[model samples]
Target: MTQTHPTFAEKLIAWQKQHGRHNLAWQVSDPYQIWLSEIMLQQTQVVTVSEYFPRFIEKFPTVQDLANAEQDEVLALWQGLGYYSRARNLHFAAQQICHDFGGVFPENRESLQQLKGVGRSTAAAIAAFAFGKRETILDGNVKRILCRIFALDGEGKAFENQLWDFAEILLPENSSEMSAYTQGLMDLGATVCQRKPNCAICPMADICQAKQQDRIAELPRKKSVKVQEMTLYWLILRDKNRIFLQKRPQKGIWAGLYCVPCFENGADFHNYLRDKQMDFDDLHECATISHRLTHRVLEIIPYECDCKNAAFSANFNENDGIWVDLTDLPQYGLPKPLQQYLA
Candidate 1:
C-alpha cells in the first residue's frame, strides 16, 4: 500500500483534538455564552477573559437578563475590562437581540453580524461554534498565521480581502468539523504562531512559506502606532465615608463611567477649588498614577481633599456630580484605576 499523509484540515483537526484548549468556560454550545466570549476576547487575553466570563454569566445568565439590566449594571460588571465601548455595545446588542430577534440568537453568520459589535470574524466564530454553521473566521490571530504561512506582505484593503479569501478557501469540508477547525486556527495562532512563534511544534511548520524562506519574523508586516500622552488632575473629595464622583461624558475616554472630577491641568483643578471657596490647605497630593491605553498613555495626579465642612453651590445638581458611599462603590461603574484608588 502507498503511504499517504493527512491533509491540512485533517492535521489541524487532529491536533486540536489532542492538544488544543478544551476546558475554557465558554466552550459550551450556548450561543449567548459564545457571543459574549467572542466580544470579550477581542483585544483581550484569554486568561483575562477566563476570569471575567463566569462572573459575567453568573450576573446575567441569559440574553433577556442582560438586556433587562441597566447599562450602569452592565458597565459595573465590565468595569475592570478596558475598552468601555465594548461593554456599551454589548448592552445595546443584547437589547437589539431582545427586540428584533425575539430574544433568540441568529443562527447564521450574516444575521449575527447585525449585532452592534459583531464583526465578520466574530460573527463567523459565533455561527460556527454555537450553531454548527460552516463559517470561516479571519480574526487578528488567523491573519498572522495566514500571513506567515503564505509569506504574505503588505497591509491594506487588498491584503485584507486576500486574507478573507484564503480563510474561506481553507475551511474544512464537513460542517461537523467546523468547531474543531475554527478552534484549531485560534489555538495555533494564539499558542504556536504568536509574535514570537514556536514553529518547531507547529503543525504548519513543515508547510509554512515564511519558515521555508527564513523570513518568519518579517512576513506579517506590523503597522506603526503612535502612542499619545495625556495628563489629568483628579480631585478626590471625601466627606466622611462618601466620595464625590462625576459621570464622564457619553463619548471619549472612560465614557459613561463614574470617576472623580478630573481637570486637564493642576491650574484648572486649583481654580475649581477656589471657585467653590474651598480651602486648598486641606488638599493632599497623592502619588501620581500612570495608566496606559491602547494608543494613549495617561498621567493622573490625584488631589485628596476633606470636604466635611464644605457646602456645594446650589446650582450643582445630580447631573453634575453625586456623593457615593464607599461601600456601595461596586454598584457604580468606575474606571479601573479610579476604582483601585478608591478601594
Candidate 2:
C-alpha cells in the first residue's frame, strides 16, 4: 500500500521551537551582523562558523563601517573562511549599500540579489531575518534533507531546481513563522538529517521516501566535479621585524586579502620582483605549501626574504609589497592551513 506523504514543515518548526539553536550571537537585528553571518556560513559548517561570526560582527559593526574599511582588514577578519572572494563581494556590497542603497539593505529580493555575494540562499536569509520577508531557503543542508524526504532523483542543477521549486511552494504565509521554519530546516539538516543522517527518530520518518527505500544517504545526488591543480610562486619578504604583504586583485582567489606576493609561474614571479627593483638576501622557508579549494589544488612555493638591515622601500606603491609588522601579523589574515603552518 502506498503511504500518504505529509509535509514535515510543521513538525520541523515545532521541533525547532522546542529544541532549536536559540542563542547564536549572530542572530542580531543589524543587517550588517546578519549579512556577515550569511556570508561566513556559505560552504562552511555552522560549528566552524560559530567561532568566527561574533568576532567579525564586532569588528565591522555596520555596513558603513565595512564599506569604509580596507580590503586587507576585511580579508583578515575572514581568515580561515575559504572562498576569500566572497568577502570581497560582501565588502563591495556593503559599499553599495552605503552609496547605492543609502546604507540600508534592501527590503525586497530583487535589489538584494543585485548586491554582491547576496545569492539566493544568502538573500533569502537576509530577507527573512532582516526584513521579515517570506523568502525560502535552499542551502546544502536543506537540499539534503528535502531530497531524502521527497526521493528527488536527478543530479546537479536538475535536483537543485526541483528543491528550489519545492522550497518556494512551502514558504509559510507569515514571515515570522517562515523565519522560524527556515531556521528550523537548517537546524534539522545540520543536527538530525546529517551527512550520515539520524533518520530513525526523524520527524519525517513516518513518510520519508529514503527511509522506505532504505537509501537516505544516496538521495541527495550531486554532479561529479573535476578538481584542477594550479601552481603558485609565493614570495615572502621579511625584514626580521616585518613581512612584506600585498593585496590581491579584486577578483579570484584570496581577493581582498593581505599576503606575500604570488605569481602564476616562476618566470612571471622573477620578472615581478625584478620590475620592482627588489633583490636581497633571501631564505627558502619551505619547498611548497598546498591549499586545496573545492575544485582546485593550489600548490604554493614559499620563498622568504631577509634584508640583512639593508634599507629598501619603506612604503612603495607596489601591488606586490606591503611591510607588515611581525608582532602585528594577526591584523593581516593568513589562510587557515597557512596560519597553522605559521604557528
Top candidate (lDDT): 1
Compared with the true structure, the alpha-carbon lDDT of candidate 2 equals 0.77
Per-residue lDDT tens digits for candidate 2, residues 1-343, read: 1222445667777888888888888777667788888888888887888998877768877788889998878878888878887888988898999999888778877788999888888888888888888888888888887778877677767656767887777666666786678788878888889888887667778778888998876777766889999998877766778677776666677765666777888789877777767663445657678878899998888877666555554434454467778788788877665566556
Which window of 10 residues has the lowest lDDT sum in candidate 1?
1-10
Q: List the residue pairs that clash in candidate 1.
A: none
Per-residue lDDT tens digits for candidate 1, residues 1-343, read 0112237788889999999999999999999999999999999999999999999999999999999999999999998988999999999999999999999999999999999999999999999998888899998889898888877777999879877876777778899999999999999999999999998899888888789999988878988999999999998888889888898898998999999898987788778887777677877989999999999999999988776564553323486699888999999999998988877
| C-alpha lDDT score of every prediction, in listed order | 0.89, 0.77
Q: List candidate 1 segments past 4 Å from native.
A: 1-6, 265-271, 279-282, 310-319
Give the worst 10-residue stretch by lDDT in candidate 2. Answer: 1-10
Every model's TM-score = 0.94, 0.88
Q: State model 1's lDDT.
A: 0.89
